[model samples]
Target: MKPVSLYNDIASTSYPGRGIVIGKSADGSKAVIAYFIMGRSENSRNRVFAETEDGIKTQAFDPSKLVDPSLIIYSPVRVLGNKTIVTNGDQTDTVYDLMNEGQTFEQSLTTREFEPDGPNYTPRISGIVECENGNMNYAMSILKSADGNPDCCERYTFTYDKPINGLGRFIHTYMSDGNPLPSFEGEPTLVEIGNDDIDTFAEKIWNSLNEDNKVSLFVRYIDIASNKAESRIINKNK
Candidate 1:
């Protein structure tokens, strides 16, 4: 699909739920990965992205207000050797752990389907960036229900072996807000990555999100040649 403006795609929707973007930076020197979460409920909004030994995890911004940790509390990003894994749920660990044991990204996700959250059955959206030997490639996956039917799950995987400069793939848990939120459809949206540095990119994404619903955002850029990474995290709670 033709690349679209990242800002507009996000700004037009009040709630895209959780999103992940992966691509090659404008200058083709780094691999870019961004993940953000938005929520309408107090329990869902009470969150912050905390840095972990390898990547980042979600934590209750106000522990007392957190009603359930089952779906919200888990690492959203993890690093395993030359691959960086990002997802909207605990499946981050599933991909990391299984890949660590010699499983391919697609193979690792076979063990998982969509989230068990009823009506919506929120899709398990995920992406992985692999930088090795001065080269970078990434892939995105979505485990969702057949339309809104939970009895059948649909899984799709999209790979970008030669990502275009200044372009990224955007995938999220929901298509838009609803009583039973709609799961994202079709392939991930192709969007412009531009040439902004980590901070600028993160700032743009955070600002584009609906002010009242945005929770936390994480953006990271990895040097394709050196494997060095620079990251920025923005938490609405603070």
Candidate 2:
């Protein structure tokens, strides 16, 4: 395999849209997971991340300013036992519900597709980090339109059974900023997870995102041996 370029700094790109990063921490003692959202429109920008009973949810920063909640508002993270589920859209509930009924991640996503926002048809990106028997593994998926054709939906899932220490993979909703935004292609990009401190790591990522476009960010570190978790959240609006 060709050496995957390490995305050490996320600010290098102007807009990565929604993104997820999963990997093991530098000390190799915990599994690190991060999810962030960015937007270009007023409706998309008027949002914040709020902690929920099991995970985190996106809420309107100013309810009166929320134009459409159809696609912008939803739970982004949920914890079901040792599985921590995260996604860019409502599929977070789908994966949670299906898993409760004894279904695999891939099986749950089979029923969903890309977003309906064309000409962008924004891809739905999802991820789950499974900590079992003191070992950590993760899976990432992207559902997008086939060749920009709304009629056909394309789905791809990548599983990482042996997460490398200090390394992570990043997948985002858009390849970059554009008129009719392009969907992220190929496998998730490899990234470096430098700090063992969740707060430091989360701040670094938040600082790296494009200031004007970044909306909210969430990061969690789960101790593999004890299954204990620590998390940090940052909302640009707040």
List candidate 2 segments past 4 Å from native: 1-9
Candidate 1 stretches with Cα past 4 Å from truth are none
lDDT of each: 0.94, 0.90
Model 2 weakest 10-residue run by lDDT: 1-10
lDDT of 1 by residue, 51-149 (tens): 988899999998989899999999999999889999999999999999989999999999999999988899999999999988899999999999989
| Top-TM-score structure, candidate number | 1
What is candidate 1's CA lDDT for residue 63? Answer: 93
- Model 1 pairs whose backbones collide: none
Candidate 2: residue 44 Cα off by (Å): 0.5
Top candidate, metric lDDT: 1
Candidate 2 collision pairs: none
lDDT of 2 by residue, 23-97 (tens): 898778899989999989999999999999878999999999999999999999999999999999999999999
